[model samples]
Target chain A: MAPILEARHLSKRFRIPSVKRSTVREHVLGMLRPSSTEELVVLDDVSFSVERGETLGIMGRNGCGKSTLLKILSGIYMPDTGEVIARGPITPILELGVGWNPELDAIDNILLLGSVMGMSLKELRQATDEILAFAELERFANMKLQHYSSGMASRLAYAVAFRAVREILILDEIFAVGDAGFRERCESRFRELHSSGHTAIVVSHDPRTIKTFCDRALLVDRGHVVVQGDGLTVADAYTALLTHEPAAAAPTAALPEAVPAS
Target chain B: MADAPTRRHHWGGLVWTLVRTDFKARYHGTVGGFVWALLKPFTMFLVLLGVFSFIFASDPVYKRNLLLGLFLWDFFAEGTKVGIISMHQKGYLLTKTRFPSWIVVVTSASNAVITLAVFTVAIVGFLALTGRTPSPVELVLYLAYLVAALLIVAGISLAGSVLFLRYRDLNQVWDVVTQAGFFVAPIIYPLNILPERFHFYLYLWPPTAIIQFSRAVLVQHDIPTLRAHLMLLGMTAVVFTAGAAIYRRFAPRAVEYI
Candidate 1:
């Protein structure tokens, strides 16, 4: 079967104005002088594909455009010169409880965020109890989220998002939060989804996670794909790249092209 | 493709949730709660009625007309004002997910619609107390005008919200426009009070046509001409289309600025 998701020659560039003018008065004064902009290429001709049910891990250092790549794939940000073809709905857990209203209780927030994630009202309503149970916040389900601890809120967000996951899930730092026990539950749940043939593209800095959880992985450095291979190989490359001097030449030509899934 | 219905269902559910949550969050922890929604236009109506009654003492239906005018004007003013800032208020949602951007503006403006619905009940009570209930035909005509007013607000808001991301001072500019609009739209006094020649100019503003025609049908028991109806429809179409066009041009880049 063809890949469930394909990104072809994706490139994104952002222009940063030398002087930010966000007011009408400042804009009026800005016309007197020609403003200059510095262009930043966040992603450069990056190409990749994910087969159905496969987990693709993206390993990168800070500011290497990992999050930007995920955002583009999830349709949160449009690529400047390329396209993303998704065969099915994409549930992007870029941030948990994105539309959550702190004034609302857990049930209301589940309804809000779940719908925002493309779940129907009936599905969300039926799954509300299950979500609350998963988060272990059944007792606090009626309480306002603002009054809850940050960890509790994070749990609720994860519970709600997991319930609302659709065809393809794009997760950013899914294991970055929660206690060890809660992280264990998340990992098991993720494994269950993976076994059930839910395609996912997970971005993380931890090589161990990529090695253990991902079937295939890509190492990215400064807007270029450094290498793509089986999980362990790419993870080792990421670790080795970290120790090398920043000024050392990147092994861009030596790496093989990202093989599109057949 | 088979899940198309599910996608529609989700968007509908999302819009409803956002609107409902907005209504609750605005009134949460308040002493008056939802009552404040009613009190705002009613209080303004009372103040305006008191002052305007002295000026138009000769007209018998002045009270009803003034109340209706205020309610309609309040909806427009409140809707656009809230709608303009809605994108920024919901910036977190836009940046974190992929959904229709227009939902943010519509949900923010919908609070005004709910307030107007509640105000409609109050209007009926006031009309009954004054022994001047509108005919069914008049109510229908008035409803059509209310829809037109809403479209005008939606149009302005659609453009305003996107523009607001770049021009942070847009709300202040809108405040000035609405402040001037309050008097220019014939909210406190009837349009006839102005010269007949200037009436055409006043009608050029969409709200002016909406408020005046609404008052003409519901309070004055007068049916507007077919030409006037067409004019209102044309103006609404133009405003809404222009706003949608501007939004389409700019909204794609809105997330960057936000």
Candidate 2:
């Protein structure tokens, strides 16, 4: 099958300015001196692809470009030297409730958040009751979001997002939100999406989630993908790396096929 | 899907929705709600009335002119103040979504417009109570000046909002500038009190021209000279164009800083 999404030679660098050139005097003085900026390479020549109806798990240690890769794939950030060819509409739940207004009521936020995530107004209006019911927020629909707890807010966000899922979805640590019950609901939703043949790029640190849900996976470290293969190999490598165990300690020897290094 | 709704919608509906939410959210928890919007200008009017009413007790028209001037000045001052920080205030929207950034600034300024509209009703009611109804042409001229003032303020606000993102000191500088502007513009005092040489400077600042031209037509029942009208239009165009240019150049990259 043809790939649904492909990122080629993806790289991104964030610049850290050492000087404060806010004032006119400092601005001129800084121009006279050598430029003082340190570049942090967050993603370095990392490339990957996800086929149609595929679940690709992205695992990495903190600050290892997992979220940045997701952002680049979602077109929130322009890669310094790379291209992402995506075949279908992509919904990125990078940060749940990122665009929510705390002062607005739950129903109003539903409209705002749904439209912002690319759902049509008609669709949102039609799905309002279902979304509110899914979040268990029907009672608080008229109340402002500020009155809702963080977990409740995320639940509402997830509900809206779940209703708006299309052919391609990029979830960056979204499954970690809410309580155990909501997480279970989310897991079931993931299963539903899986059965429906939706292509997904899921970034999570949970080994079980990867092992159970992902068809294939990639483990990134320090802006580079170090392992790529079926879910078990990549999950085991990630677990072994986290536990300070060597590659041989991860049942790599017992497995006849070795995971490919990306 | 790769063909997601990246295409910008006809954003009029969205902008209006945002504006309504912004306006409503501000007063959601407050006891006064929208009355707070009117409270500031009315309180200022009372204080100014106490200070200047005695001095111009013999001339009721001077008192009316001063109040009108204060109302217009308040609109310009409050609009630009909110507008300059509008982009920063909506930083979440900017970094998270790909909507047009200028609408953020416009929405912020529109909050001031809502307050101005409320005060206008009071002013119109007051004029009717005092049996001094403005001619339809005068009202039209005054409305024109009011619009020019809003555009000029919005233009300056757009430029300031973008530049202020990179330069944190601008808020302090703007506070000083607007305070200085409050004194220079004919708000509490009439333009006739200033020396002839400064009249040119006043005309150059679009807000000042707007305040004076509006007062001339609405309060004094006098038509503005053709030169005065031309000056307001010219300054409005220049400031608006400059603001749009600044916004276009810096707004796209502004999300990175936020």
| Prediction RMSDs, each to the true structure | 4.3, 5.9
- Candidate 2: pairs in clash: A88-B1, A88-B2, A89-B1, A89-B2, A90-B1
lDDT of 1 by residue, B53-167 (tens): 9999999888878888888888999999999998998887787667789988878987899889887877766776878888888888888988898899999999999999999
TM-score of model 1 (CA atoms) = 0.93
Tens digits of lDDT, candidate 2, B1-258: 133334335455557567767777887745489788777777888898899778767765777777777778888888988888888787765655445678888878777888777777788788878887888998888789878988898898999998888876677778888898888787787677678998997766666788778778877889988886887788899999999999998875676666
Given candidate 2, what's the lDDT at residue B200? 90
- DockQ for all candidate structures vs. native: 0.49, 0.20
Cα lDDT tens digits, model 2, A34-146, are 75666677777888899999999999889888988887787666677778888776777766655578778988888766665666667778999999988888999999887
Per-residue error for B146 in candidate 1, Å, reads: 0.8
Best by DockQ: 1
Residue pairs with colliding backbones in model 1 are: none
* Residue A76, candidate 2: alpha-carbon lDDT: 66
Per-residue lDDT value at B256 in model 2: 63
The lDDT, on a scale of 0 to 1, for candidate 1 is: 0.83
Model 1 lDDT tens row, A1-262: 8788888888777776779889887899889888776667778888998998999999988988899899888777778877787877788877664445677888888887788788889999999999998888999998998898878888887887788887788888878778898898889999998999898898888888898899999988878887899999888888888888453246543222333211
Scored by TM against the true chain B, the candidates give 0.93, 0.92
